[model samples]
Target: MKLSIERAALLRAVARAQSVVERRNTIPILANVLIEAEGDEIKFRATDLDIEVVDNAPAKVERAGSSTVNAVTFHEIVRKLPDGALVSLTDDGASGRLNVEAGRSSFALATLPRQDFPVMATSEYDSTFTAPAPVLRRLFDKSKFAISTEETRYYLNGVYMHVADAEGRQVLRCVATDGHRLARIDAELPEGAEGMPGVIVPRKAVGELRKLLEDDEMKIEVSVSETKIRFATPEITLTSKVIDGTFPDYSRVIPQGNSRKLEVDASDFARAVDRVATVSSERSRAVKMQLDEDRLILSVNAPDAGNAEEELVVAYADEKLEIGFNAKYLLEIASQVDRENAVFLFNSSGDPTLMREGDDTSAVYVVMPMRV
Candidate 1:
């Protein structure tokens, strides 16, 4: 195989492919990126058994062939090459090495037969739909932070994506929780996804998929089956196996009748919480909140460390309330509100609390309080 590709195009393709290649791989071929030069484009494919990503870039191909080269090593070499210098890759059938040449730099990298690459098998998707990149971005971005890191409850370690009715209309939804905090975000359902099956997208795949959604106007083609999910754009395709488990029914966890209302500027509340949490110890950073008619006081007290207190003017009309919560949890949930105020609903100090951006029900968060 022989091909010439511009430095920027080559680097972008290799960087996307190598993210799936683990630093320490048990299988030799898994450490390599499968490169194929054909027609007027080159394709770079990488996989880790569970997830696979393929990136396509335009190139000047003199000969049509394929080879597998170390993804990490090739990426490093291409990254160091001078800008605008054309990179040439060549492999002869008899030699076990691939030649990389650009400007005044040259290197011979070991190659594995392209036939050894483990390509994931394709399946018939029960549902396929197209969504704007910004819509999909909000669905995953607002919920992924709450995904659990616990291995035992593997079901909770991903975002549960499905179609559900919201405000008398069908909407696509993403829900994630770690038993302490829960995030639910909703987007308008696409035309062909009415019958889509619910699936749990693993944390790693969610992160990798995010990189593809930077363009707000791009439309992403999403395909899903019982066992697999695929997201594709014009130049890249990402496929992964969905987690095989049942997500707990989260509706029960969302508080229904919590009427105590507190409205505060999201930015102000976040800053106050952060300031008061400084005196908390590393072990169990807890911040106590005291609410009255129109004032809120955030305080933190740690026996080993010092104490801190901060006050903010808020809109609250319910009875006096005192609640304690994990400092990290409050900060995380607060950051979700963009330029709007964060409205919180409470039933009691021990009961789970609900927060949302202004009065919008499309994105809701529930956080369990900690003992002060």
Candidate 2:
């Protein structure tokens, strides 16, 4: 294939595909990007067995053909070329080499046959829908922090996306948990999603989809089947295999009857927990919170080291209570509360506690307690 493309356009196309190709895939073909030129368009495709991304950009097509080149090396070379320079890609079938030239810098990247590429077979998708970029963004952003790292429960390693009822209204929801903390978020249901199959998109897909959803107004077309899922924008399409496992029923962990409530400024609480946890050793850093009436004191005590306590005036009027939680967990969950205050509901010191945005019900988080 022979094609000439603007450096900026070339970088944009190859960057997406290269990001999908892992640096250390076991198969050689999986590390290369398939470049095809035809009808004034150049397409960059790359896959790592599970996820494949294709990018199409406008280019000057001198010859109509296809070739594969190392994704990372090509991306690096294209990145180094001066802004707005012209980049040409040329390939010869017999030599198995693709030449990339820009300005005085030129390199020949080894090529593999494009026929080796594994494309996802088309499926009669159970459902297809479109969602505003911000809606999808909020759905993933609020829940991804709680995705499990445990490899055994692979289903919990991704944000669980499905349709559910939230306060008598059909809502698109995303839930994730690691047995310690759980996050559940709801967005207005989009059309054509009544029969959608629940898919546990792997962690990498969540990340890649997030980068593409940065433009708030950009609408995304999502297609889902039992084995694979695809998300597309105007120029890019990403398809990946869903984890073939059952997601544990996450509803039980969401506490319903927790009565004790503590309302504190989210930023202030996160800051207090962060400052107190600084003294404790990494492995056993726990922050003890002593709550009484409207006054709260957060303190961390380590036997060999010193201690720290910070007092914050909050909205609490319950019986005296003392609870301890992992400082890391507290800081992370607290940071997620973007609004001014975070409302935490406790049911005894051992059972899981609940957190919500002030009094809002659309988003809620549950966190397990750790022994002090």
Worst 10 residues of 2 by lDDT: 117-126
**Whose TM-score is greatest here?**
1
Which digits, one per residue and each the tens of the lDDT, describe model 2 over residues 71-92?
Answer: 8999999898999899988987
**Model 2, TM vs. native:** 0.97
Give the number of colliding residue pairs in candidate 2: 0
Q: What are the C-alpha RMSDs, in order, of all predicted structures?
A: 0.9, 1.3
Q: How far is 149's C-alpha from truth in model 2 (Å)? A: 1.2
| Model 1, global lDDT | 0.95
Best by lDDT: 1
Off by over 4 Å in 1: none
lDDT of 1 by residue, 1-372 (tens): 999999999999999999999899889999999999999999999999989999999999999999999999999999999999999999986699999999889999999988999999998999999999999999999999999999999999899999998879999999999999999999989999999999999999999999899988899999999999999999999999999999999999999999999999999999899888888766358889999999999999877789889999999999999999999999999999985699999999999999999989999999999877
lDDT of candidate 1 at residue 109, scale 0 to 100: 96
Q: What is the lDDT of candidate 2?
A: 0.88
C-alpha local distance difference test of each model: 0.95, 0.88
